[model samples]
Target: MAVVEIYDTTLRDGSQGEGISFSAEDKVKIALKLDKMGFHYVEGGWPGSNPKDMAFFQRIKNHRLSHARIAAFGSTRKPGVPVQEDGNIQCILAAGVSVATIFGKSWDLHVTRALGTTLEENLAMIEESVGYLKSRGLTVIYDAEHFFDGFKANAEYALATLKAAVRGGADRLVLCDTNGGSLPEEIAAIIRRVRDDVPVVLGIHCHNDGELAVANTLAAVRAGATHVQGTINGYGERCGNANLCSVIPNLTLKYGHETIPRSSLAQLTDLSRYVSELANLHPNPHQPFVGSSAFAHKGGVHVSAILKDPRTYEHIDPALVGNRRRVLVSELSGLSNLFYKLKELNFNLDASREETRRFLEEIKELEHQGYMFEGAEGSFELLLRRAYDNYREPFKLESLRVIIELKENSPVYSEAIIKLTVGDQVVHTAAEGNGPVNALDNALRKALEVFYPDIRRMQLTDYKVRVLDEKDGTGAVVRVLIETGDGERSWGTVGVSTNIIEASWQALVDSIAYGLLKNNGR
Candidate 1:
């Protein structure tokens, strides 16, 4: 089987995404991860664009990589300057990489209007720039910018541009759909034409404006391209670039093309989450293959059949992508669903079927009262433990009070006082924080540290709020969910109240209780 090479640009093009930025250290860490993951090429950044990118290239000199070659990206030499004299060329050389990728204009309109250079001069620039790089003993990959749109407008000019790169000693010619609006069939047809005409290796670089970047890139590959360029998680300018997370699985699993090692397929979900957290971004729930909701079942009938045989509802085993099937416990759950959840909590169900039915009914009533189990698995586990009489109280909440002081000309200040009992000893603590929720969390953790020093190892990682009954106006019920994690494990708990502080406090208390219980194996 022929293997297509994957070139990841998450640290380069991905950083171009709006509201996204990665420091040089962050770029180096992600680059190291990609290298270990077996990407064929990793584009670190454009050396001249920013100080951070320049620092990245300088810092990577001391490291060793297993599988990936670092590629420095830049444009072709300026319209008239000698290739050796161009600042972009100098930066590319300073990057100290074995391979360099340079993009040149393929459209006549761009050459004439944007570049203010004749089409023939632009062609000469392409040839001279690539020839100069090759003359320096560096492998060059030429990017033919706007190839698809240019081909539609003037097929001769676009093909000429690619031919110039090939004639000038480029090892590969990457045809780029820079604007990212071309369809799969259009990409396939153009790639086929180029493959027949240009003898050099063909590659693809696609953006995601039309949401067809992955489709178009795969189509180009089917038409004989061997190299694929994309950013991890689809982070890039505008609508973003093709997502390697989506492309890698599609190629290896669906199309039987070898890119990443077959055994590494199972690490997809963890890899996705790792990158998202490192970037301080949330993962998209609808993302293919590795999303949290990728295999979630909620409808009663759907869950019923899935419980019998998951293949009835699922397209593939989620474990293949490092994700697991999740049966959502909601107001719609039946007795079978309750039993399934109980089994997960290691609770033995009684032989009385009526009791199970009563449990399901009560779950629905609680859900209607603003309890949400989907995001509060820890709370659900506690409920199951209580139902089976197997739960032990880790600590007792003696009292919790929030005091707020408001002045006419001063900012309001809130302090939380928490009193707790652990093993016949009572501890009291008070703290001030930005809000009632933060203050309460601090006070509780402070008081608990005396008894459970291990509490310092955990933290509240995420918090979310939902309005359960908007029709009730100020009297509407609200649900709060808190996600906590130690270095190894993560759990979530939920609480509901009309008062926001109360809801937050309830979830916060459950978070600590669940952590203690799990730590002690209670």
Candidate 2:
């Protein structure tokens, strides 16, 4: 299989996305991660553009990478300026990276309107900038910015820019869809045309403005481009860059081309979510290959088929990408959904049993009352174990009361007094919190900590509320969902009631109970 070089730009172009900001340390950490994953190149950042990038290049030198070469990104020398004198060009040299990626204008419009330079001067800039980097013992990757649009506008001029880079001894000529508006067919056809004229190794860089960056890149590769450039999770400016999470798997699994090592494929999901964590952005659950919902089955018919053969509903075995298959149970589920869910929870109930049928109906009835178990698997597991395995509650709630007070010039005060029982002993506790839910949670924990010290490791990560009936206004039944994590793993539980406090208390109790159960290895 032909190998495609994987060039990641998460530290540079990815940070251009709104809401994404990677510090120098963060960039170094991500670079090390990519190296360990066997990416060919990691574009650190534009050293000329920011101090953080310069610091990243300096700090990354202390750590030796195994596979990926760090690449510094910048533009070509300014028009009419000496290549050695241009500050941006000099910064790439000063960054101490073995690879330098420099982009130059291929569009005549950008030359006249953006750079206000003559066409010949732009070509000179491209040639001189690449030559200087190469002379400094750097592997030069020349990015032909806006190559596709420029080729459509003037094919001869775009080809000329590539030829200039060739004259400067560029190691690779990367054709860029800078505006990200090209179709797959357009990319394939243009690469065919360019292949006949330019003699350097061809590469591809695409944006997702048309929602086809991945498609366009695949098209380019099939049409003869060897190098691939993208960002993790498609983080970039505007619509974002091509997502390597989707790209690499498509290349290796679909096209029989090699990218990162096949054994490292299982790390794809973790890497995607890890980058999203540092960016402080939520991972897209629907993203292909590596998302939580990519291999999830919910419908009755689908779950039935998946139990027999997962390929019936899933495109690929989710385990190949380190994601697990999830069968969701809800009002729309059939007996198959319940059976599959039970099997996952280590229960093997007969699907045809009368009690099993009754339990399925009960779950449907609960869902109709606004208790959604799909996002509350912790609650669902408890319900299942109780129904089939004769499970006992660890603690029984006796009563609870919440108080909220506000004064003229002071912060609002909230307190909760809770009473519960463990075995034959009754426990009473009082605690203060920021709100009614927090107060209830604190008091509950205070009451139960002595019996189950493991509860201290559990922390509430998310709480969500939804009004089930809007027409009733204040009298509407509300649903509360709470997500709790204990460092290593997380679970979600849900509750529904007309009284907000009651709903919150139910969810809070389930969250803690589920954590305890997991800790006990039950």
Candidate 3:
């Protein structure tokens, strides 16, 4: 199998994105994860730019990496400065890594306007900076920033910049789509021309401003580039960088390139989410391969076809990327969706049964009334069980009351009182909370915990309320969705009502009931 190198810059380039900030410890953690997954290179950060990056270098030295070579990233020597005396160049050498990646101006516009230097001096900076790092026993990767744009404007000057890096003994020549405006064909054509002039190994780096970074990178690879640069979730400045989460699968599964170990490919989804968590960003559910909704089927026709063979609606087996196929039940769902879900839950409800047909109709009616089960699988399961002949109620609600009080110079007070029967026992409880719904949740859980102690393990993670009709004004019906988790697993439940408190109570009760059902091994 032919191999292509995978270089990750999430700790460096990705952190430049808005709302993304990683501590030195976070960088170390991500680097180790990349190493474990067999990435060829991990760019630590610019040591000369910040103390956090310097701290990263000092901390990473304590642990030995298995697969990835940690590369220190920096720019070329400043114009009119000696490479050896340059502060950025000195930091690259002091990073103690075997690999160093330095970028220099390739476009003439940037040469004069961005760098404020003569074209000849820019070439000398690229050569001397790469040469200095090479002489220091570092494998130098020279990035020709804005190479695609430069080639389009002045092809000869761009090729000249690459040749300069060659003369400097640079190990790899990376052409960057820094502006990310180049098309795939443009990338392919430029790389083909550059390959004829530059005799070094080639790599491709791309931004996502044009939303074609991954496409442009693939074009460069087909045009003879052997290395690919990107971040895990495409996190970067401006729009973002090329997402390696998409690139890796496209390379290995679609193009047949050997990149990461095929066995380790299953870790891709987990790795993407782990990085997003550390970055304090919500995972994009619609993102290509690693997203939660990547393989989810919703339409009745699609679900019916998917039941026979997943390939009917899916491009590839989701498990190949550490994800699974999901059959979502909604107003658009058919009997097939219910069947698939029931099979997953170890139920044998016949599709032709009258009760099954009525159950499906009931779900449709609920959805028509603003109760969407697409994101509320926990509530769907409870409804399905209720239709079975052997089903039994876990607990019964008798009455509930909530109170709110306001006093001058004092914070508003909210409390809830609940009465419920568990088997033959009646338990009543009262609790105070930040709000009426929270107090209701607290009081109900407090009442149920005596009978089901495992309920203590469950906690509400998210609560979202959507108004069904904005034109209905203050009397509009609302839908409440609650996400609950039991440390290891999480599920969503939903309720719809004209009263917000009543809607919240229904979803909250279903959440606890479903949690108890799972804990009881039912």
- TM per prediction: 0.96, 0.97, 0.95
> Per-residue lDDT for 423 in model 3?
98
> What lDDT does the true structure give each of the candidates?
0.87, 0.94, 0.93
lDDT of 2 by residue, 1-522 (tens): 789999999999999999999999999889999999999999999999999999999999999899999999999999889999999999999999999999999999999999999999999999999999999999999999999999999988999999999999999999999999999999999999888888888999999999999999999999999999999999999999999999999998899998999988989999998899889887898999998888878899999998998888888888877888999899889999998877887886788799999999999999999999988999999999888988889999888789999999999999999889899999988999999899998999888888899999999988999999899999999999999989888899999999999999889989998999999998
Model 3 lDDT on a 0 to 1 scale:
0.93
Which pairs clash in model 3?
A: none
Q: Is candidate 2 or candidate 3 better by TM-score?
A: 2
RMSD in Å for candidate 3, one decimal? 1.8
Model 1 agreement with the true structure over 448-507: per-residue lDDT tens digits:
887888799889999999888789988888999999998877888999999998999889
What order do you get sorting by lDDT, best first?
2, 3, 1
Which lDDT tens digits does candidate 3 get at residues 39-65?
A: 999999999999999999999999999
Poorest stretch of ten by lDDT in candidate 2: 341-350
